[model samples]
Target: MARITIIETGHVPRKYRERHGSFPDMFARMVRAADPQSTFDIVSIPDGDALPDPRQVQAILITGAAAGVYDGLDWIAPLEEFVRTAHANRTPMVGVCFGHQLIAQALGGTVRKSDKGWGIGRHVYQVTPNNGVVAGEQLAVACSHQDQVIEAPGDARTILSSDFTPHAGLLYANGTTLSVQPHPEFDADFAHVCCELREGSAPDAVVATAKASLAEPLDSAKLGAAITRFLTRR
Candidate 1:
């Protein structure tokens, strides 16, 4: 069993709080499915309190957030430093959405507010011509973000992409670091909540797709595959 630490990027404000399962909930579910005996811990590191010692955590999964990676938030920089250091140390890492952007930015990539507006709703992402991170023909995922990575970092390879976002996913160092633009952690009710969170109008088919996912959490299986790939990498 490996110990994994998740750095939470969602700020729980008064507007969204209660018994409602939070973003960490989805991330947690994924990790558990991936590695049943894995140890997981949730910490609100918005302040970027020196990242956990890598020796203690075999892999780190950074969750998605409402804010962009280039928002100039105080915590983003330190977190970026931690990301780079972890990568250098061979600690398996998986970043989601903003996490994906930060990994690119930390490694000399570019992140900017997209003029095309928010990529909200259920969109399709195409796997790279040949890559293992996405490991599928195509994936229909939930997307919600205003910023996009225009270019991949010096050491990263674009694995998955879509017209709306060119660098939808990046696979680094054969498999050590993987970042995804979409939110695979979202289920049906959570998807609907997120849709409402983004004020997105849920149509019939979209709702149905989302509902099906909620009933059967394949996101965890996908995440489990990622964990196995990352930890067992050569």
Candidate 2:
């Protein structure tokens, strides 16, 4: 069985957690659904949890955070360092949302809060040519992010993109790293709750649109399988 270490960067709000479990919990469920033989070890860095040895970990998966990559928090820098170390070790690493941005920034890419405002809803991404990271040519996913990787790392190539987030997914040239701006672990119900949670913080219209878009078809499970493949495959 492959062992996967999930670096928990942050948590869901108390209210949201009560209804939909924590972020790590969500990821655990999704990964299990994709690959039942896989085992997971979650390390919560925000709670001051120490990172486990990368040598013992078969793969490293980074979870999304409520904080932005440019927030300059003490833990942020260390997390980036850890990301670099994992890359150097050639440990298969998968990043989601903030994780995606952090991986890019750590590997000489650029990430910044977009003037494009928040991308919150079921967004569609057109898979870049000949990049087999994603299963489909076009995929719709759950997204909630204001920050984006404006410039990809020197060795990373774009794998998935959309009009709102042109650099939605990235794959390092070494083929050991993958990252995406959307949350494949987020099911439709969770996405709906997130949309509702943003009622006051986001524009009313945006919130409503997000909530409505959840009714549309989502390819989260397919993406989950692809993620499982990336981590488990040699």
Candidate 3:
């Protein structure tokens, strides 16, 4: 079995947790949906859980969190340190949303809350040619974030981007790390619920547009498959 460690950063709100479960659970299910032979180990580092040795797992994945990399939280620096260690070890690593920004920030890149405001719902990204990281020329995935990786690390190659999110996907030159600003684990239904949950925080118009955009099909499966390929590729 392919062992993957999920470094949990945050939990879904209690209201949403009862239904779709926590973020780590959603990610675990998504990974299994792409490759059933996979097994997972979840470490909630934000809850005082310790980071495991990077050498212990076949691959490591960082999950999305509500927090930003520049938040100055106690755990943020430690997590960045862990990311660097994983990179130095040449261990395969995958990051989603907040994880993506954290990875970039940890590796000499810049991440900041975008002035373009929120990017929610299913956004289409133009895939750049990078062997097979992107399955097609365009990909639509669920997104709910204001912060973004403004400047990708010097050694990182962007595999996907959109007009709204220029540095949407990043692949490090070391060939062991891949990150995306959107969430491939989130299906349209869950994405809708997320939009609804953010109704109070986000603008009503933004939420309405995000809800309306959910009708379009998302290419989450394709992205998941690409992530699996990256984790298990020879």
Point out where model 2 deviates above 4 Å.
none
lDDT of 1 by residue, 1-234 (tens): 676678888764435445446677776666666666767777667645556775567788888887878888888888898888888887888888888999889988999987766676666777776675546666777776778999898778887789989998888964588888887776545555665554444355544554444443334356446645565344
The CA lDDT of each predicted structure is 0.73, 0.89, 0.89
Off by over 4 Å in 1: 12-20, 47-50, 200-224, 227-234
lDDT of model 2, residue 87: 91
Report lDDT (Cα) of residue 9, candidate 3: 94
Return the TM-score for each candidate structure: 0.83, 0.96, 0.96
Tens digit per residue, CA lDDT, model 2, 1-234:
877899999988887788788888888888889889888888998788998777668999999998989989988888888888889898999999999999999999999999887889899999886787775689999999889999999999998999899999999988899999999999998888778767787889998898889889999988888888889886
Question: In candidate 1, how many Å is residue 48 off?
Answer: 7.1
Deviation of model 1 at 68, angstroms: 2.0
Write model 3 residue lDDT over 1-234, tens digit each, in one string: 788899999888888788888888888888888888888889997678998887667799999998989999988998898899999888999999999999999999999999988899989999996545776789999999999999999999999999999999998988999999999989888899878878888899999999999999999998988898788665
Comparing 1 and 3 by lDDT, which wins? 3
Candidate 3, TM-score vs. the true structure? 0.96
